[model samples]
Target chain A: MTADFDAIVVGSGMSGGWAAKELAERGLKTLVIERGRHIEHGTDYTDFKAPWELPNLDAVPEREQVHYGGRVIAASTAHFRIKEDDHPYSVAEGKPFRWFRGYHLGGRSLMWARQSYRMSEMDFEANKKDGHGNDWPIRYADLAPWYDHVERFAGISGQAEGLPQLPDGQFQPPMELNCVEEIFRDRLHETFPTRRLTIGRCAHLTAPTAEQQALGRGPCQSRSLCSRGCSYGAYFSSLSATLPAARKTGNLTIVTDEIGHSVVYDVATGKASGVRVVDAITREHRVYTGRIIFLCASAIGSAHIMLNSRSERFPTGIANSSDMLGRNLMDHVSGLGAGGYMPGYTDQYYKGRRPNGFYIPRFRNVTEDADFVRGYGFQGGASRGDWRRGGGQAGIGAALKQDLRKPGGWSVWLAGFGEMLPNPDNRVTLHPTKVDKWGIPLLHIDCAYGKNDLKMARQANRDAVEMLQAAGFQGVNERKAEPDEPGRAIHEMGTVGMGRDPGTSVLNGFNQAHDVPNLFVTDGACMASTACQNPSLTYMAISARAAHYAAEFLKEGKI
Target chain B: MSISRYSGFSRRQLLSGGARIAGGIAVGGGLAACADSAGQEASDGLAARLDTLTTRDALRRPGHFFSIAQFRLLERISDLIMPETDTPGALAAGVPQLIDRMMVTWALPETRSDWLAGLAAIDARARREHGVAFARLEPDTQFDVLSRHDGEALSASDRAYRQMKSTIVEAYYCSEPGATEELRYDPVPGPYRGCVPFDEIGRTWAT
Candidate 1:
């Protein structure tokens, strides 16, 4: 059967945006489906609003506050996040999993922290050496060019630290570390020669290039209001960068508020023929056919769609010949760190509200052996305390006001992101009876951190306190406990991972489905292992690389 | 540092009104519709009808969850916590209104009850000490009652007092006068300077 479009990308987020742009620019009639409402670029953003201007002073409404205890929904970007009750997902008994999601046109790209870091050769080879998860078919060298390509377009601001485990990427001028941070960095490095702390590699244009400027994007003003959506297009987001490029190609069509239900497979062709979508507002079911399909609808979303896609040949699900489709779920073990005061930096203060922070690249298990197999990295910053500190103090009235007018003592804290080993037991499946408001079967996520993850977290916390104490910091405090639940990091990956063997993986080296050609899953779902660094940058590179390959294959009539 | 980026209420314009004490809607440009008819009883009738009783309602009304007497006490206590010095303080910044709105819209019902109970406890102390309500008591007496309550709250780890105080402090600082005049506010702070002398920028940043 002739498809309605040349290609269909079921998402418009971090990876979907790249796929749409690459496919559309290559002259394919691409249709992008978003489960959330459409948002115009500059017009939709409320980034210019001050604290007083925001509703309830940017607090969540009381009725909805219970659902937003995670601090994901602020009044500024409440529209971007999903209500927990409205979109329900169950977890396995005795296992707690938090599925933090933003399901709008740009998905999480609009509300992401924008921390961009490249996974190194060690990350790709980790699974092969350790036997924790399936071996990655591709290496850092394969995706390095794509990382360079995406970094150039995304305008990643980063300092080039010559670290092997954490590879340096093509970057704009890096945002500078503050006075206390600089001191901490020097002292820490001097004490421990193996460890390095550099400025965070973030997707904010410190200096916009001519191409970025032509796209109506400007340099970051350092407003530190990025989660509210940057009207200046200073930070990388689907609405800011990729979607505009895709629109410019004149081969893109967007259908928002359409939840992807399942992939329709043709028995004769043995390929996915179309996708069934349920209208989010009207509850109407519709099918949109395409020659090729890209499932960049997040890690779990894509897995759910694939798992629900039942067929006569593949009775379990479409392209699930190996039964490894919803297996090997992983998210970075996070929320373990230390904080302390840097006493001497009282005289020094910073100017702008720099969005990016200092990054302590993974040191453990890279140079020296750890109690755990994998390592963790720290993302942290140093800043002088503000007026809020006065709340704890015993003063009030004129004297209190005078004291608060002067900035309080300098404090520093580091948040660790540790790698989680991929276990098939930590899986996502369709709930038998329970369904969401849209009638889609609720996904039952059953994921928990293993012993290695806990050990790594503990070590990371201990190391953070040790580093702070070594740097002459006072009153060092460490969170000895690990994250109570999985998915708190929001870096979920490895459900439909890319690997060498079709029997054990869903996607191949190029992010093409092993069982079904002309089908790609190039988001976090394609990751074989959850690297200690942020995964969005890696997802961007993989999506771009896959789209390029898919386009070439289409031109050559390979499918 | 560019304060002009935050458009709506300027420090001078707010000060000129001399503590009219309108809620959240009085500050930003977007809420001009509500701010225009803020003081008029006739306009307030329409505003009241439109009020959804959400967290945002506190922006439009003097109180949401609190009764008239409770709200008056809240305003007085907030002012005492942060009195107007050279700059605008809690009362001028509409901290009580923020609390009233937050209690209804932001707080859980249990949290709201706890806050009310805490307020009643302070009033009880005032009545025992000076034979009047906390708001009607003399300034020094009110301060003494609050000081004792504050000490008890700190020692006992009272969640209600902490919540009320934090809300008041946050609301005060985020207000125009408190942000721009008392502390330094830079809406667009381009090119961060890592190390600047304390004398270069005297006040703390209002972010």
Candidate 2:
């Protein structure tokens, strides 16, 4: 029997959106399932709200504070964030994993911190060199073209520093670095020759091409209210870019409010047939059949679905022949950094609130070797304290008001994001008894930073302090705040990772399941190693590449 | 920045006003509600003028968390904390009303009582120092009494006092007249200028 559709892409987020766009563009009829309410771009965004127009100073009300678990969510974008009480998950008693999520039509794409970076050849070889996780089946050479393809369509704004560890991509005009950043960059080069500071490579349009402009995307306004959602279509989100492009292809059918429960295995055919979905609101189950299935439902989400896809042939889960379906969970080691106060430059101020920050690319384990296996990169900027700083200091009347008129002393902060080794112990499994309201098994996540990860974090903290102090910054204090939890970086990846051998991994070089030929896991789940760079750009490239091969495979009748 | 942008709130909403604090219903043109209610011209400071209007609103509007006397004391405190400078201060910016609205809808029960106790403490200090309530004291005397209280409370690191002061400062700055007039706020800054002289912008950004 013919399939209901040529292809089905699960989870309309960063990777799924790209898969949908590529599949639909290749003339394959694609169905995109989103597990949240449909959001109309621009209409749904609260970017137009002025300071005076914001309710209760954009603070989440005290009554509803219980839902957020002490995290201060801005009231303007509170709708994007799911209530923790409603969407339940289990973590190990000692270990804590902060699954910061947005379950809307565009998923976390709508609220992602748009920092985009590409993993280098060195990153692809790290696992193999150190014998951490399985070696990536494919390398930087295989993904370079796909990176160019996605970057052209998605519009990454960055400066090319010609560094090998951090490869440069097709980019628009890079956002300018402020005076202090420029000074710091020059000073750092003088002090530490290997270290380099450049503007953050973000998935935001600095110069919109005719293709992007035609799809209603424009240049960024630099308003710095991205968390609230950008109405201008300046920042690339699935809703703003891919879904629209997919729709324009006339081969895309998207259904919101349908959660992907599991992959339906056809035991007779020995290939995956379709996906089983649960209606989020109605709690009704339905099967959507297609010739091919692409699982782009994030790292943990895709793992959850794969772990639950139980069948007679694969009782552990569908495509779990290797028993490596839900293991080697990884997230970037975060919450280790330093900040300092800059004494001078009170006269220098920036006009717009630049959404992007300065990026100090990874120097350790590249130009200089570290005691640990891998290294980290620092992301931060310098700016004067605004009126909010007045609240903490000793001040009162007209004099306080007068002092607040001009911005206060310039202070800089450097937040380190260290690479995490793929440990088999840090994994996600289905809860034995506990299930969510939808009767779907809850994900019991047990993830923590390994010894090397902790060592790298401490070294990163020292590097930040040294850099700041070297740049003549005073009051150089290291950050020691609590809740330095894993997964707090929101760069979770691995589980169902790609490898050369079928016994060791779930997916192959093409991001296609080794056991199930017609099934593809192209999201963060396909990552063999967690490179220090933000994983979204690599995920986009991988998704697009996988979709390309999947389309070719269908045309060639390989499956 | 204009009051004309504040059309979401009706005349009744301007009086029965706690909904806008937490409901997030202010779509467009809803900033005028606060300015619309500030018509009573009185001598002394902006507090004395706001006292007449807020007392009436608090008495009639059931949404108001603070009582008439408590509301009046809050108005006096906020006004003194941020008096009418070159730009509109706390009273004209409706900081007291916003705080009262927050107490009803946004504050926890403990937080609300803590604010009430703080306001009562200020009044008691005024009565102990002088011979009248905080609101009844002369403008100069009110400033003296509040300044001493502010210094002591801030030095002691009083949570309630700090919360109230910060809220007032934030509210005033976020107000239309305060934000656009007192500080710079470009909603759609076309391009980023990395470095410019402070005099070029003249004021801090009130984002």
Candidate 3:
């Protein structure tokens, strides 16, 4: 029987968009399903609004904020943020997971921090070397070309530093480091030769290519109001970049407001022949069939769907012969760093809000071995505090206004993003009883930081403080306050990880399920190890590479 | 005076011009004109862009939450706190009016009550200090009384006082005149000029 589409992608988000774009471009008729409301590219964005233009001082009302679990939602980007009341998921009693999600067409890509970095050879071999988690089926050599491919399409701006731990990528001209940042970089390098600071390698177009320009994307305007979705398409987002590219192929079909409930496993075929979806609004159920299925939903999201996909043949879930489908969840150990006031640079200031910051690559275990096996990197910037400083401080007259006029002293802060060792205990499972508005099972996220993760946090904080202090930064304070729980970094991954052995992991080297050849997971769910760098760029590369392999496999009639 | 709303710069201009428009603003220093152009656009236009969002009509209407007597005290206190310098002051920027409207629309009932109690305490203090209400006191006397109250409240870390003062400052600075005339207001800064001399870009960025 002929399927409805050649390939069915279960999401329209970060990796799903890439999957759809690559699959469609390679002459595959693809279906992209989104659970959120439809959002037009440029029209829906609020980037043009000034502070004065926004209502209620650009703050969500306390009454409405409570609906969002008391999370402060900026009025400008509030549309992108999901209301907790509408999309409720259960968290384990003691394990508080701040599952910050944006359930829109573009998903978190619209609000992503855009700091793009490639996972080096060290990151891939980390799991095997440490034996914390399952060894990755593929390594840096396998993904380097794909990273270059995606970086060319999605413009990454950065100054290439020849570091083994954090590999550089195909980059446009890097955003300049400010005077204070330059001083900090120079002093810190002089003090500690191993630790090097370079401008953040972000997926923002500093120089728009003919390909990007042809897609109506332009160069970065450095507005720094990117959380409110860029109308300029200066930043790489699914809505701005991939979805449009997929649409241009004319082989892609998108169905919004159709939430993926589960993958329908055909007992006879031993493959995921179709996806079962529940209508977000109508509460109606439907199934869309395809030759192959790509679960590009978020890590937890895809795992939730797979775990809910119970069948008689595979009682646990589809493609769960290994029973490793919903295990080994991970997120970056974050909220550790330091900040200090820079004494000089009173005569100098920076113009325009640079959306990017400088990155200090992982020095621990590479340049200097720490107590922990894995490592972390620092993402920070230097800037003078704006007039908002007057809100908390003393004085309220002309003197206060005058003091606030020229901006305050330049202060530098470094926030650490460390690799979280994947533990089977840190897993996502469906609640036995609870269900969401669409009658889909609620995701029970039971995740917490391990001993090594906490140790890394403390070490990261100490390293940050020492780096700042050694650079002659006055009033340097260690940022010891860790995140209340995991997922604060919003870098949740590794629910259905790739491994060399099928018994240990779900996906194989090509991100295809070992149990079900036609089923692929190229999102964060397929990540074997939680790399120190941001994972979106890796996800993009993986999705593109997986789609290429899947296409080749289809042509060979391997399935 | 009503807090003027800016518009007119289409999403098309923002998207199509991209870095070029931002580059022009960085080099030319015509951000004030760009910010003012937003105010020049029809206020109704904003309503069409965003769903269920209307610009705060603080100065366009009478006091929403505050009583007339209490409003007079707020107006006096806010002006004293952020008096007219080269830039517009709190009163001119409609800060008191904005606070009053926020009290009714934005603030929770507890917040409204706290602000009311804080306003009453200020009046009571004025009456105790000088045999008159705060609004009735002489300009210099009112300044002295408010200054003392400001110092005590700030040092004590009084939540209501801090919130009120912050609102006043925020409302004034976010105003078109305050943002454009008082501080630099760049809507679109093209390429980031990371290090520029303080004299080159004199005023602080009105973000």
Candidate 4:
């Protein structure tokens, strides 16, 4: 018996959106399933709720904070960090990973940092160049066309500087850096030849093209609150952009609150027969059959789905011939940098809100020689504290009230993203005894920092402090940098990685599973190497590439 | 005829319960307006004043958890924490309401009771220094009485007071008037003008 839909994509995040759009646009009856509730663009955001307007004024109770401190990684921290009551995850003690996240149709892509930069040939060629975990199946050249496709649609706003490291993409007008940032950028250019500082190329609408405007998107109103999910549809999100495009195809079917338990694989045909889903609310069971399946349920999420899918065909997990189902887990080592008060720029101020900041692309380990294996990039900005800061000062009464009417002092901070090499030891496994409210086994993650990661973390802090001090910023404090725990950066990657060799890797260059031809893993799980910059752009690129190839393969009857 | 005379109930309640129940009354009487446009000074000031009057007794009458003396002392201390300015003060943010909410939600029975006892002892110190109860003192006397308790870092009452002060300030600043007017709240920024001279624009943009 044939399936109802031509293909079924298990998530609606960055990868799932890409899969759905590509499949439907190619005239495939695609069903994009999301386990979370549907969130509409510009309306579902809690950011519109003012401070006093918050249910409990956004305060994380002391007891709750201590209890759920570890789970507040990239899980649901876009608005306020997720309270224990919201999206709760499990982790073994002595080995805790704060899986900060939220469950919605668009997923974390709605509240991503919006830093859009392409990973260069160096990044793709790194594992091959230095005998790392495994060679990336596809090179930069192979993935370049897909990147172009994603950018042309996503509408990245940035200046097209001919830098080998940060490739220029389809562009709109870039947001201007403030007076201090201009001075710093100008000064930094003169000081360092190889190091380039540019305005953050973000997935925000500097000016909406007809393509974006047709999607009911408007120009960037310059609200700095993109993290709370932009209500204006001025930013790129599955909710705001891609899903709508898929809906227009009239061939998309979406099912929310149905958690993908496993893909029913037939060993004789060596193909996925259908899939089972557990209802998030009622715990009811349902089966969905499709011609092909795409796993887009985040990095660890997709892996958990894969590991949980145990059939007699493959006991370890589906497509786990190499035993690489839940290994090589990676997330950027964040929380390493410096924040300081700028001495001057008191007279300088800007109008409107720029949701983006200045990006200092990878310098240390990229161009120049480094002690560590990989690289790190600095996402820094020059900004003065706003009126909201008036509450923190010791001042009260009229003087306090008057100052509140005005602005606060000038300040700048550099938060660096450092890349960590994948290790099998740092892995997430299913809990043997414990299960969640949904009866799914708890994800017991055991990840710790390596020597190389610790070194890179220190260097991230060191370079930031040194540069700020060089700019004559007094009272510049270097926050002690350490990769304290896993999942802090929220740039979760690896598990089902891309590799050239079949024995060493699960998926090939096309992100199609070696064990199962029709199955594709194109989310953060497919990342071969974790780069220093934000991973959304890379995810978009890989996803776009996989979806197109999968469509072609479907036509060819490659499975 | 007295309605429900056997049950000793009022006639108005009987009539209201019988019929004539009304629908479609204007909702959001004031809070909605405050949330919408905080820039409107008069409406915001009135809302804040109403907030204070409604919850003002939170500091007075003995808290469900606090002793009578302790409750009275806390009321005196909270007012001094945010003395009135040109605009409404911390108490105007309905901080006492926040305190009572916290007591029910976060605090335990014994810890709240111990703090209440400590508050009474602290008030005893204030009373020994002055003639009347702590809440009855003038603004100057209130400050003098509170200053001694401010930095008693070792004392649990002092810790509780600091937490109370922080919550009050946070509530005030984040209030419609405090955040929007005083702090100049801007959720979404307009346009990003990179590297403009101060003369170009006279004011700062809220992040």
- Listed per model in order, the count of residue pairs whose N, CA or C atoms clash below 3 Å is 1, 7, 3, 18
Write one digit per residue (lDDT tens) for candidate 1, span A288-330.
9998999999999999999999877777777889889889899
lDDT of each: 0.83, 0.85, 0.83, 0.71
Give the DockQ-based CAPRI class for model 4.
acceptable
Candidate 1 per-residue lDDT, tens place, B12-62, comes to 443343223453433223232322222233323432443221122233332
Candidate 1 local distance difference test against the native: 0.83
Per-candidate DockQ values are: 0.52, 0.54, 0.38, 0.26
> In model 3 chain A, where is the ten-residue run with the lowest total lDDT?
A478-487
Top of the candidates by lDDT: 2
Best by DockQ: 2
Candidate 3: residue A110 lDDT (0-100): 91
Over A1-559, each residue of candidate 2 has an lDDT whose tens digit, in order, gives: 8888999999998999999999999999999998888999889999998887787888897768889876777999997988888888999989999987778888888878999999999999998998999999989999999999999999999999999999999999999989888888889999999899999999989999999999999999989888888888999999889999999999999999999999999988988999999999999999999999999888999999999999999898879999898899998989878999889898999988899999999999899888999889999998888988777677677888898899998889999998999988889999999999999999999988888988898888888999999988899988963327988899899988999999999999999999999999998889999899989999999999999999999899997
Model 4, B21-112: lDDT tens digits are 11111111222222222222332243233322222323222113222333345555555655455545545454444554444344444334
Over B47-156, each residue of candidate 3 has an lDDT whose tens digit, in order, gives 23422112131222122455445556677777777777777666656666567656544666566656666776687787788867776788888878878888898889
- Model 4, A1-559: lDDT tens per residue? 7888898998998778888888899988999888887776766676566566553455543334544553323212333343445445566678667676656788777757788889888888888887777888888898788888888788789988887777788888888988888777776777676777888999988778788889988888876667777777888888888889998999899998888888889878889877789998899988898888999999998888888888887787799888888888888988888888767667777776677888888888667777888878888888776644543444444554556555556778888888888787777777788776777776767777677888888988888887777766668887764754779888889998888777878899999999999889999998888977788988888887888888899899886
Give the Cα-based TM-score of candidate 4 against the true structure. 0.84
Give the TM-scores of the predictions, in the order they appear. 0.92, 0.93, 0.92, 0.84
1 against 4, candidate with superior lDDT: 1
True contacts kept of each: 0.69, 0.79, 0.74, 0.49
